[model samples]
Target: MGRRGEHSKSEIECMALEAAEAIIEGEGFDALSARKVASAIGYTVGSLYFVFRNLDELIQRINGRTLDQLYAGLIEALSDCRHPQQCIYALGGGYLAFAARHPHRWRMIFEQQPRDDNLSIEIYQEKMDRLYELMEIQLKALAACPEEEVFIATRALWSGLQGVASMTIGRKPDREEEQWAQKLSRHLIGHYLAGLGTTQFNSRVNQSVGRLIDCPK
Candidate 1:
């Protein structure tokens, strides 16, 4: 067993998060528990509680880190692209690549709902918004529309990419899955952007479309 003073409180928190991530990465979220993490980190279950309020909090912490890594990956993916359309394609491919590489951790960001709804909602929403904003920037450059319309376009394109990831990335990661996801994402983005450019969507058209469907802001 790990001695009480062998690791500082912050060190224990870091160790616990690392250990929990390993457990989730290897065996999936169902295999994660406070007892499992504590044992992996060579600490008693009580030590874990000292670091995290509960397993839900630990899960949220891990998901937060996963989202950070995802954001970094997307930033790298778009670094070399020149055009706005290219950047959007880079975003989609990068997203698919990240999901393919870390299917379990990536899936956990969306699949597992937090038991502590209030805390999770506030923290996770900010991270998700950052991801959406990356796409928003490119969509705004592509479509000369009001800020409200740009926001709607961003969500619409991203929703399609998310659907592609969900359908392509199955229970197990495979080389073929990544290739398939890439092809499907490029096809969808190509057609979607083509439609966006061809359509005569302005503030008036946007307001009319908004009246028909309940779209989130």
Candidate 2:
């Protein structure tokens, strides 16, 4: 007989995540299903449902879990750097590395689209606020920049990360893409640090964010 698995519910959730990640890595999210996850972990589909009300909830949970991991890694990457510019730079590099290391999990977060007033949306907003707080701290440390400038620059910095991460996780980026991602990440951060080319940068980023929210809901 096969060996028994971990007994705790949380442990099963973790295992489920592991299975989900494998599915993502192998075939992308479009191919994911409870049966696949259940087969991966030797659990039945009913057993999986006992933990997740539906696939959306399971995906949301996975997104939340992976985002926290990404946040922790980025924080660790920036901890040793003193200058805010360096912190932001390290943040971009760490962000790319994390995405590469856990491509499917990273993609899920990048592609998530939660419905308004959903519990998962609330959770997502809370996490977003925390990330924004980190950006605020970094901005506060640099240039004595005004609140408006910081908001503009922060959006640029984050959107650039998202853009680069998406390329890396796409259908096999070429060598130029790999090299350009590094160059692009650094150049993008530098662009923001260089005053976003003007205070107007914030308004521009806001408009763009408002128009093109491809990153799920």
Candidate with top TM-score is 1
List the pairs of residues colliding in candidate 2. 112-216, 113-216, 113-217
lDDT for each of the candidates?
0.85, 0.71
- lDDT by residue for model 2 (1-217), tens: 1223545667767898888977887787888898998888887888787777777778887788777888898888888999777888888888877776776677777576655348577558777767766776776676445577667667767887888778654544455555667788888788656643343345447655321111111
Model 1: lDDT of residue 193:
81
Worst 10 residues of 2 by lDDT: 208-217
Best by lDDT: 1
TM-score of 1: 0.90
Model 2, global lDDT = 0.71
Clash totals for all candidate models: 0, 3
Candidate 1: C-alpha RMSD after superposition? 4.9
Predictions: Cα RMSD each: 4.9, 8.1
